[model samples]
Target: MSNGKTKTDIPFRLDRLPWSRWHVLVVVALGITWILDGLEVTIVGVISDVLQKPLRWHCRHLRQVSWVLLLNRGSRGSYRFLLPHRQVREEEALHDHLGTYIVGTVLSAFSFNFASIAVFRIITGLGIGGEYSAINSAIDELIPARVRGWVDLAINGSWWVGTMVGSALSLYLLNPAFFPIDLGWRLSFAVGASLGLAVLLIRRYLPESPRWLLVHGREEEAKEVVSEIENKVSHQTGKELEEPNKTLEINPIGSVGFGTVFHSVFGRYPKRAVLGLWLMAGQAFLYNAIFFTYALLLSKFYGVPVDQTGLYIFPFAIGNFVGPLLIGKLFDTFGRKPMIAFTYIFSGVLLAITGYLFMIGVLSAITQTLAWVVIFFFASAGASSAYLTVSEVFPLEIRAMAIALFYAVGTAIGGVAAPSIFGALIGSGSPVNVFYGYLVGAILMAAAGVVEIAFGVKAERKSLEEVAAPLSEVIENPY
Candidate 1:
């Protein structure tokens, strides 16, 4: 265990720990970022009308610029290479960074002018992008193997919680009868920022990933972190933890480059790469196309007032949130491929039917919103599963990067295109036009579901190491 390399059982030890209060603390601390994101996105959507007069175009440009910058450089292959090293340099720094961004978002809302708003959006986007990589890696490493699926889906689904909060807030804040337009929007941002501050306090107590420590050759530190976790679990449960009898021999590797990540993901696991792209891109297209334009559809087609859009959004968010909470456990019980495919295909089918009804002028605003609730119930679970899939299928060494890469690529292909296309269709004042966009999204989702059926990995209840061996693992001989 010297000369820049070490053999260790740290990964096994971490994976075998029982679910405890400590795990819940980690989930609450880290998973709150998703809620922050949902809140930010919902606020922007709800307030789009308020900004239309003065800052609307500017805000839109800022959003596009921030997304491009973050997706391009933040998730690049080189960026992924540096993630583990960054975590090793300081535990909880990533969490602090996220909190700082939330603070910046609050400040941005108070900006007196337009340029400051753009700057704040970029800062906030960068922080959220960073959180996506770091939090996924940490959660996957810390959670017990048996329950990882349910936990991951639940945490990811929690985004809708923020959506619900934002919608409820907008119902009050966006109302001219209750609050002035300017004050309401600012308060919304303040509320989100406040949540971020609370998350920072909770994250302060989180420890570094012991698997990361052992792989980086910090065996003593790894052992210490694991021992502390075990002690807490034992005290809480009033039972002793069993010794880790399993061991893994890993020959530590030096830094990996973009070429290594490219080769591993595409060269060695080409089928997995394709499956990931399809699943991610499909969900991204469906979600972004609808979510980004939902308010517009309501205001334009249904005659729903802009301020009152939150009334519709509240229920939509509930369905999305409940989908994962209700059915997420089935991914573990029934198997990943079956459940993922079912959600994707089911949602896609439902979306097509809803879109057809919408085009024929048979659906009112209330019915349309209800249709969305039903469609996204399945779609949300499928979307959450997409994140779970990419995070789990890749090797630990490149887990962060893999999540980043898939997210960036998928977002670029589907997320970026969806909004623009949908906006144009909606602008043309034609329901039929929008229906075509829905069909495209629906087809992509269902096709991705088929791809999952063909190629998805059944990763439920399996150790991350067993699912995908570390690039640094040392093979043993039976001779």
Candidate 2:
């Protein structure tokens, strides 16, 4: 590896490894970020009313700004800005700053004022958004191609684990019978901060991605890291590993510019870029529209108390968690295009049925919640697959940015609009009004499925390099 160029087989070697305990370690260490995200989102959702009481928390604006910031800068641009600086190692800088920012945000909620909470939440969103790029890039590079689909889906699905925990906590903490009004929401934030603290400690042990190192001209360091991973996996599995069968020559580049990334994605892989945007935007619209305002819908239409809303969320979270766990492997087996389309279309159809029932006034609160469970059961897997699609289909150099770009675009186009529209419809006190909102979500989701069927990349079980050739790949002349 010299002055921005190297010929090596690091990508192939990393891809050919067998599934082992080391993979699990990587997943647990890196993927906990999603769980933290889930906890934060669900906590805010459950406590929306509490934050709006006489205290004037104005958490709605705080949440909206945080989310938009997170979607825009947090996922795509922030990591790139931070990684090149030498004041701290890339791994240490991200992990430490993320922990500090999240802890500080949660702690600020104790202040019970709008301004402080808004400031903290903006910082928190930036931190979490940075994690999205760094973590997704690292996980994709480190995990084996054979099992990457299942692992990515499972990690993304684990967000619902945090959701379930958040729901349970809100049920207990939001209850005035147990805790006073002001204290309950403050304690909920404290619990989320505690979880962030624990994840910080775990992140310390995670190594930088060897694939990233190889591409950046750190061949010796990449080799050393891979060797250590091989040793650990072999020891744990009690078996010898086979040699890698594939190799590719690469012209390693130092730093990729934003211009190159943009040209490569939109200029070279335009269809993929569109597919990713549709998948991500569709899910964001459906999820943000429903999940953010679920409590409001129940309290207003079904007469469910705010304190009891968490109980309904618990099962919904379970259904979401189960979807990816159950159907993730099919992405690898049945292939990406068919399964993604099926899940998206199926969930959309279910949501349409549920919304119709909801509009007709035939479904009670319990039945409505059950309908959500079934609809999201399929939706969760499809949403998880969206992340998988964007991350894997891009070249190694631009994978993180691609994920960030599509995520930001999708969030901006669909995610930002859905919540306000749904909130307004709910506030209008007419189920039929809200039905139109649900119809929009359903149509968008199903349209994304159709887009997948028409254009989705069949990337399941393919090495990342095979799915999208590295920008640095060399082509030798026959002459």
Candidate 3:
């Protein structure tokens, strides 16, 4: 019953429309994945108030101070002054463990966050890994080629939207008044989990990328899914979809495997990978060092109100959001090296200025907050763009692995030292000289920027395959 041609021969089918409604749905669903990601990363910030409580333990009896001192004083000159130090006879290592916790027990504040954060960060970071890769691959596959750049920009940019929403919820609904003081952070987590579950549900409707499937030799499945998309688009638009020119298809780019990613990217583009990795690591160090400890820093250094800390962080997050979206486009339009270099250079200078202001005691609360905003703006923008450019410069086959490895190594190094290093520098019980820490961060940031400029590869207008093939040839036939 076909009018002009067989329905099977029709290039654009109802189910596989070029501008299908289904594709739009898929993109939105992918955005939710990232929202969950952002929420997971920042959820603990809202919960720190509750997590800081010290665990309680009951002692069996009040032993005499003389008995305690006589039993267990260590071998030292001070011990000779004391008759003897006594140890509490206790069950197993419980007394030893409890003794450590008891040191902070009498203090007004809590202590669990120091340990809880380590575990929660690992869980949240795992989800983040999946979220970044899944969303990028989904958008690349789903969006049409002509509008791909905009889609890429739009989807990746949506992460900031997710972050802002989490911040708003943390500020308003997740406050202690809405839930029991102990459960306030739980509420924020529940909200984020619910959103994550919703995204998981919606993702069920998304078909695998036809291009990816085709490269894997699932041609029939790819064709069927493509047809389905065309059909959906046609039905939504109430117009027949035009078929893509069949002759336009190119040969399949060579498939990259696990090792191929390292070989292709690091072996061929060693300078770019090294430069990107350093920048990435430095960015993580600075972001975590500042963001994790901002409240304490502001309270002590700037005399900012405790209640206003979230407000200050919100503006910094806004800067983080804006930097990536705008800078990424410039990376696409102009060049990666230039944008990366400019962002880091300015960010470093601003950080130094911020430190100097604090050091000199000339910065008022508002001015200090402004300084944080400016530094974070440039830092976050360059950081995000660096990841984007790194991915684009690798072949599609190895792109995922490259991103995962780079981020994993960079973030791991940063994660381990951020707390201890920043704490030592800022919380050493001396007069708060936060400026010294910022000065160090500025130096590292500027060094990363310079190294990137000297060695970073330009991927301004190249496709992944184009970037990878020549390198492969050089490797196979090096002179």
Candidate 4:
């Protein structure tokens, strides 16, 4: 890697390895990031009602204001830009975020006013927001290309697992009879943050991305990491692993800048940039707008008590988690473009139909939740695929940073405003208004599906280098 020059078989070595304990370890180690995020979000959602109810009379006061608090968190995703240029190794970045979130989550234990809650949530968001880039890129690089889609989707789907657990726990925490209203809700965020300490410690045992290593002028470390992983895989399987399928040779560069990534993502691969944007924006809006604020809807129009909101959310979480767990393989088998498109389109149509039912007063609380279950069954898988599409389709030089960019941009375009728009609509206390919000989300998702059909890359089963060659390999921008 001297002079940022190296020819290596790192990609082939990783892509060729069979699923083994090492792969499982990789999944467990890196995959838990989503689970943690799910847990945090669920806890926040459940406690959100509690956050507002410092006084019984003032309970619904922050109903509309809660949406702005959520918007504050989404805006903190701009913290991701701080690392895109540097991409400090995974565990280190996780260390910074894990600690930052833990501290912020702990601080929320004392929040009373809108300002306090808002500030603490921003700190917490900054922590999680910065880490999304590291874990997604690591997953794609470490997992075998053969099963990358399934693994990625399944991991992404685990987000609901956290939500499920949070929702279930909320049933107890939100019960005024079970615990003091103020104390119970405050505990949710704190306890959720506490659980992350163990995961943060576990992540320390994980290795860096060999693909990342090769590109960053650390060829020897990359080889050592790969060799160690291969040995473990052999021992776990009691069989020799396959040899490299093909090697990626390049004049490895140290890093990429905004100009390089801009050219590569937009100039070199314009369609992919558009596809990534659409996929990311649609999912961000759908999740942030409708899904994040569901508890409020149940409490608002459905006349469901706040304590009971989680019970309804329970089935919804299961539907979302199961969607990608089941539908993930299709991304690998049916191909990335079609499966991504189908799921997005199908979910959008389902949501529109369900929104119509809700607006017409034909749906009960139970039916409305069930409708969410059916819709996110497809939507969950599609949303998970959005992250997958962005992570793998870019060159290795900018892979991790590229993911961060998409997430931040998506959060800006889709994440930041979706809540305020929907919040205003929900605050209107009209099902018709909320339905219009749902309609907007559905339109965005359906349009993204259409874009996928036109521009999505054929990345299924392809090595990272093959899907999009390392920037170093490109003659035009050889670093």
Best by lDDT: 4
**Which pairs, if any, clash in model 2?**
74-129
Candidate 4 least-lDDT 10 residues: 56-65
**Model 4 segments more than 4 A misplaced:** 54-64, 84-87, 475-479
Residue-level lDDT for 271 in candidate 1: 87
Candidate 2 Cα outliers beyond 4 Å, as residue runs: 56-97, 474-479
Report lDDT per candidate: 0.79, 0.79, 0.54, 0.81
Q: Candidate 4, residues 47-157: lDDT per residue as tens digits? A: 556656657333365454565356555745556566566747665776777677777778876776666767887887877776677778878989999999999999889
The better-scoring model by lDDT among 2 and 3 is 2
Per-residue error for 225 in candidate 4, Å, reads 0.8
Location of the lowest summed lDDT over 10 successive residues in candidate 1: 68-77
Error of 4 at 179 (Å): 1.5
For candidate 2, the clash count comes to: 1
- TM accuracy, model 1: 0.91
- Encode model 3's per-residue lDDT on 1-479: one tens digit a residue: 11221112211122134565766787686666555555544544433323434423211111211111111111101111111122211111112222222221111122133334333333344445534544565564466533444446556656656667766666664455665555455556556656655565566676666555444334566678777777677788888766543321233333455455666667767876877687767776777667656655665566654434566666766777776665556666666678778888789898888777677678776777777777777787676665665556665445545666666666655533564466455555333456676777787788889987897766554433344432222345221
Clashing pairs in 4: none
lDDT of 3 at 209: 62
